[model samples]
Target chain A: MNAPTIKPFGECGFIAQIEGFSSDVDSGLFANAVARALRSNDGVDDAVAGIDSVAMRFDPAHLGVDDAREMLLDATNNTPRNTARAKSKTIDIPICYGGEYGPDFDALCTQLKITADALIKLHSTAPYRVITLGFAPGFVYLGELPEDLTAPRLKTPRLRVEAGSVGIAGHYTGVYSLPSPGGWRIIGRTPLALFDGRETHPFIFEPGDEVRFNAITPEAFGAIRRAQK
Target chain B: MMAIATIDRPGLQTTIQDAGRRGARHLGVPQSGAADRVCLAFANAAVGNRWDAPALECTMTGPALSFEMDIGFALSGADMGALLNDEPVGRYQTISARPGDRLALGAAQAGARAYIAFAGGMAGFAFFDSVSTYMPAGLGGLEGRALRTGDTIGSRKATMMAPVDIPDTLRPHFGHDWILRATEGPDTESFNPKTVRHFFSAPFKAGRRGDRMGLRLIGAEMISEDARAMKSSAVFPGTVQCPPDGAPILLGPDAQTVGGYRRIAQVIDADLPLIGQIRPGDRIWFRRIKAQTARQTTLQRQILIASFVSDFSLR
Candidate 1:
């Protein structure tokens, strides 16, 4: 792999970008590893991993800009280019597809020219890994959605997308862990809570976690939702 | 904790904010703190409280409250025209109030936000060890939301200190014109040289859609050379992002951790506080500076403010 390009993002922040790297599983793992290494360093405030870049913010009082830049360069060099797949856990999510839970279901079905059952099968059959958590707390971006399931985001985003709303846009599928304004096209809704601030772990999914969705009836979704509450 | 005051009128959007949650951005949590850290620290310092202590951050308008106990407090940031018991009081100085004293503040005369710090610092729900309110996630602050009428304001333990008056020279001056020193971004190459040059030279007006999250700038459209939608990347406070629509949005302390917009420049740490005080229609001009110069300015400002507020570092 070519050396990553390191540039100053702000006065105290630096971004080490891996150019020519596609948003694939391997790239996510590599970017996440670099971020983890950067975060463990002293004086580093935050080291967030993007799809193909790792942005790091450090304390200028403790670490100079040159030192921060060196650290970023070192992170890219030290991090194994061919990182061995670490032990990851696969979690199952129960989803109720098509209907009130998915506002864009009909439009998406018409656009894709597929039956509702075929679309559901295409979405749930493939297992996706968490690329990166962003935009909101516990919001996990699962990648490489089946080509048939990929859809464009809504032109005008919804004012409030309920928590656990399963959305698809481009080649990524994500769960709206919090009720927030979102532009992703919703096709299903999960009954499980993705984020619980009071808990020790807080988030259900982390980077590299494998996720598989299990289609359920609306009645089961209601039952699981009530039981959890 | 004891109830220190009863909120008679909650301002337009008043919430308890501290230094904000750190080390959580990787998990998608924003650094939602006092938009203007300088003012927050100054208010806390005047009352002899820790610089990062939780305080009420009032936006646009200020709140009215009746004290239930004697307490020492100070107001900083925007001049909200605060009055104690119908008597106008000055800002940036510690003021003592007796039980049953009512304090009211009107709309801001200048600037956009104000900070009210109590003697013992306000008590608020802690999330990730910070009480800064993040309304979107409904985390931290009082019940994870803004203050409302009839809500009781609680305090830790009151510790009265010798009244300290912040000198006029040390206090930050607020105005309609703001010049934010910035460094070119990690994605600066995404835009052509002409667009980048136009961005720095042209003056932009803060649009009406301004909030703690971000401020949209209305000016010359900054068209990116590469029209393809960029992948989502890490964005921080002071990141100037240009969407496909050509408008630029200046991210704030409460902005999302990552976004897909093309970043043009990032405001330096020293000038980040100015972004918090910017109001709609305020004239904003971005001054280009190198990262080394940005660091030097931050250090100079930190040293100047540290003389009055001990242990204060503008990081």
Candidate 2:
């Protein structure tokens, strides 16, 4: 594809947009190319790769915006078409579906006019891509759940969503790394810790990684949680 | 006595902050740091510590800390009517404290946050190579949360130094109203030119719900041209996002790494210190400038900050 247009994100930031990634069909390849290039560029201190574009944040103290813009533009022009895919790990998250762990399971199934078993099967079957990470540390935003399973956010958010709670909103599914107030519809909960600062790698998943969910008995979930302690 | 101190009373939301976790934005980590870097640096410098040294960033209400050893400390930022062992102390100056000395801070008569710096900085565990506290995800500082009463914080090393005060001319002016400079949009085109114009000229009051996450403004709604939800994009501390409902949410230091709303403008780095002082009900005004001008202003501010070496010249 052609080089993306570079725009000023803020005074010290720049966004390189690869337009129409939503329908481009090979948007992931383009996004990965930009993310890899910008991350390795010394002028750019941090780069966040979104679904279709990349935002580069720079320190004006060391690198001026003009210089940063040039380096980013140059990087995009040299998009490595033959570059290998970024290193990724496929993590299998053990989840307890449709019970006390999923407070809104019955309500969600009823609203969507689907059977609990069907909903779980559909959700567990697809491998979701990690689009962009944000909202909280290690909070993975996996996307494009089959159109049949897309759901709107709760009108009012829950006061506290337990850590490990797996939920869906719009076309995205995410796991809460910490207990925080959120509006997504909870479908299940995971026994594995998504984030732990003490670990060599704090986050279990990174952007561009693939994730699959596996249903487990609540008793198994309890055993895993206990062992994690 | 060893190099240690006890929190007699942890007022409001006091937490330890440093320069913040860097180079981790791609991992969705917020750049959690002192709300007012300028003041934090001033406090640290006064006590002969590095600019990014870990220190207590006390909110509107301040904490009451009692030392367990002789220590050198400095208080900066808002005027909190501080006291040392019941004797009134001052802001922007380093004071030597005895083992039993108590450093107490009263309600902020001006500004919204206060910073306290100890010599050699506070001893704390690091998450992602920084001691700055990110409360949302529970990382960094003391157990990744705000300070509490009965908390005992230690220091690896302490130094005894003579008192030094920042000159009045160099001190930041904290008040009920503030004028902040900004650079218009990564998403300004999504907004009507008229609304963008209004945004720069309108008077907005800081809403009560604001925290380190963001400052919600109430006044002169900024409407977008299409009002459609945009794809989630990168956002930083100073990003001013205009949601569909038209109200602007000016992000703060603890803001999420990305957002989907239309980010109409970004507050300049030079005037970011004013962000920490913006209290609920404070009147706010924005002035738009070119990206080049914002960089120039920040450079100028950096030069001024560097000149603050005067406070440490006596050492």
RMSD for each of the candidates: 1.7, 3.0
Give lDDT tens digits, candidate 1, residues A1-229. 5888888899888888776555566677778889989989899999998888899999976887788899999998889865526738899999999899999988899999999989999999999998888888778889889988888889998877888999999899999887777899999899998887777677888888889999999999999999999
lDDT of 1 by residue, B254-303 (tens): 98989999999999988888999999999999999998898899989988
TM-scores, in order shown? 0.96, 0.94
Give RMSD (Å) of candidate 1 vs. truth.
1.7
lDDT per residue for candidate 2 within A43-137, as digits (tens), equals: 66788866666788887657866789887787767776433245367888899997989998889899989999999998999988776666667
Worst 10 residues of 2 chain B by lDDT: B306-315
Q: Which candidate leads the pack in DockQ?
A: 1
Native-referenced Cα lDDT, model 1: 0.88
* Candidate 2 error regions (>4 Å): A22-29, A80-87, B1-3, B158-165, B309-315
